[model samples]
Target: MDRKGILAARVSVFIVSICFIAMGIMRNEHFVVFKKAVKICLECIGLG
Candidate 1:
């Protein structure tokens, strides 16, 4: 594709991803992910 077409595609994809992230945040999914990450880290270090 041409440069303009590529730019438009990139912008559209970015907007869609931002929307999904916002939706996840609204549902409190970020905290759940953070908790899981912390748990995994603790387990890896034998503290969980």
Candidate 2:
């Protein structure tokens, strides 16, 4: 795509990311998901 199209795509992605983060924070899902992710990582590394 052209410069304007690329800029628009990046802006939309940033906006969506921010909105998702805000919703996760408001609902406390971020921390819960983080905890689960860490657990999964540890298990994958054979340290769980």
**Highest lDDT model number:** 1
Tens digits of per-residue lDDT for model 2, 1-48: 999999999999999999999998999998998887876587678886
What is the Cα-based lDDT of residue 38 in candidate 2? 70
- Candidate 2, position 5, lDDT: 100
The candidate maximizing TM-score is 1
- Per-prediction backbone clash count: 0, 0
The lDDT, on a scale of 0 to 1, for candidate 2 is 0.91
- Reference-based TM-score, model 1: 0.71
Candidate 2 root-mean-square deviation in Å:
2.8
- Give the poorly placed runs of model 1, Cα more than 4 Å off: 41-48
Q: What lDDT score is found at residue 46 in candidate 1?
A: 86
Model 1, backbone clash pairs (residues 3+ apart or across chains), number: 0
| Per-candidate RMSD, Å | 2.7, 2.8
lDDT values, one for every candidate: 0.93, 0.91
